[model samples]
Target: MRNIKIVIEYDGTKYKGWQRLGDSDNTVQHKIETVLSKMAGENIEITASGRTDAGVHATNQVANFRIDAEMPTHKMRSYCYEYLPDDIVVKTVEEVDLNFHARYNAKVKKYVYNICNNKAHNVFNRKYEYHIPQPLNVEKMRKAAGYLIGEHDFQSFTTLKTKKKSTVRNIYTINIVNEDGNVEISIQGNGFMKNMVRLIVGTLVEVGLGERPADGINDILDKKERKYSGHIAPAKGLFLEEVNY
Candidate 1:
């Protein structure tokens, strides 16, 4: 078997999510798998580095699968480009070592969230960005994000209620930039649970809106309760930017 690694870019507005459900074909994974399986003349199952919520986009999501076919990697990639829908694109495909598992071998992931802090929304960007009519304090958001850096038990920031798995994750950095009326926040972390990025962004947004103080982030982390965190940010504003192995 040949282990192939593929990098994918997708505009996930229409899909239910990344994973394929038993009852529905409206998923990114199912869409790609259907095309690849046809090309390989066999059922193909690709393992992604992580899952993105519905409406969340991705610039460089990574995945890998083992194939028994003798087709060239470039040909396989070309087949995907021709068969997959316009919204999903396979950026690159290369043969990888047998030990390089997409999910287990991933070292870091970077997610970017965009907010249009303008009084009115831009027609072109309305689909991709979150609009906040009121002005935001970008500095406050940055200050609040500082408290979330480093390793922490992020139980409060995730929606996964089951405590059987570890909630501890190492957040390497949080970079917030404000340009004109656009506020972009980039978070680099070791790993994240379900809805973790959106929840963290929501907490920072509360601070930016003056609804919560920057110092309150530490208290939220200490509470270790999902209710203590702010509202979940809209899925449209979130993007999986990169996955580093």
Candidate 2:
């Protein structure tokens, strides 16, 4: 058997998320696995670098799986592309060592939340960007984001239904960039709790709208109370940008 790693990009507008759910009808994983199993002529399981929530897109999601076929690694991309849907594409494929588990070996994951701050939405970007009509205070948003960088217990920023035992995670960077009526919040971390990025973005939006003081972010972190934070932003705005190993 040979282990293969693949870089994937997908539009999550219609799917149920990345994982293969028993009861759910469609998923990114299930779509890819269906094509892969047909090509390999056997049952195959694909593991992702991370599990993105429903409606969350990905630009460089990675996954790995093993197969008994001796096909050349370079040809694997062509084979999968022929069978996969238009919204999902295999960017690259490479043979890797057996021990290269995509999830456990991931060193860092980078995500970006995009907001279209203009009065009118662009029809071209409707599916990818979130439209927020209110004007935002960029400086205040930056200040709030500054407090989120570094290691902290992010229970307050995550959903209450999170199943992870430990809520402690290290955030290497949180950058808020505003350019020409577009606001992008990029966050890089070792790992993230469920809905953590969306919640963080929501809190910063409150700060940008002057509803929450810039310093309130620090207080919220200290309190570790979910109720003190802002609402979770829509998943359509979030994108898994890349995974570093």
Candidate 3:
């Protein structure tokens, strides 16, 4: 068997999420698997580096699957492009080592959240960005984000109630870029719990809106409770930017 790795990009507007749902067929994973399974003439299962919630876009989502077919990687990629929806595209495909597991070998993941900071919403990117009409204190938001960088238990940021084996994650960097009427929050981390990045963005939004203080992030981390964090930001604004191995 040959392990094939593919880099994918998807709009995620019409799909439920990356993972397949039992009751729903509108999922990115199911869509790709169906086409690949048909090509391989067998049931095919692909493992993604991580899952993106519904309405979240992805620019460089990575996944790998083993196929018995000896078709050229480029041919497989062309087949995917021919069969997949217009919104989802297989960007690159290559034969990989059998030991390369996308999820287990991921070293870093980068996510970006886009915000429209003007009173007027961006009609072109409305479905891809979050609209915040109120003026945000960008400097304050940056200050709050500074406290979140480094290794720490992020239980307070995730909505999951069940205990994870380890909530501790190392955030390598958090960048907040403010342009004219637009803001982008980019975060790079080793790993993330469910809703962790969105929750961090929500807390920073509160700081930017003056609802929460910049220094309050420290207290929230110490508490390790979800209620102490701000609201979960909308999923539409988030994008899976890259996965580094």
For model 2, name the residue pairs that clash: none
Model 3: colliding residue pairs: none
- For candidate 3, the 10 contiguous residues with the lowest summed lDDT are 158-167
Worst ten-residue run, lDDT, model 2? 158-167
Cα lDDT of model 1 by residue, 2-107, tens digit: 9999999999999888984467788888899999999999899999999888899999999999899999999999999999999999999999999999999999
Q: Answer with 1 or 2, whichever has the higher TM-score.
A: 1
**Listing every candidate in turn, what is its Cα RMSD in Å to the true structure after a full C-alpha superposition?**
0.8, 1.3, 0.9
The true-structure Cα RMSD of candidate 2 reads 1.3
Q: What is the RMSD of candidate 3?
A: 0.9
Model 3 lDDT tens row, 88-175: 9999999999999999999999999999999999999899898999999999999999999999989899986787478899999999
Alpha carbon lDDT of residue 202, candidate 1?
Answer: 92
Candidate 2, residues 1-245, lDDT tens digits: the string is 99999999999999989974477759999999988888888898999988999999999999999999988977779988888989999999999999999999999999999999888987888888878889999899998888888999887988856555888899999888889989999999999877899999988988998999998877898887788889899889999999999
**Please, what is the whole-model Cα lDDT of each candidate in the order they appear?**
0.94, 0.90, 0.94
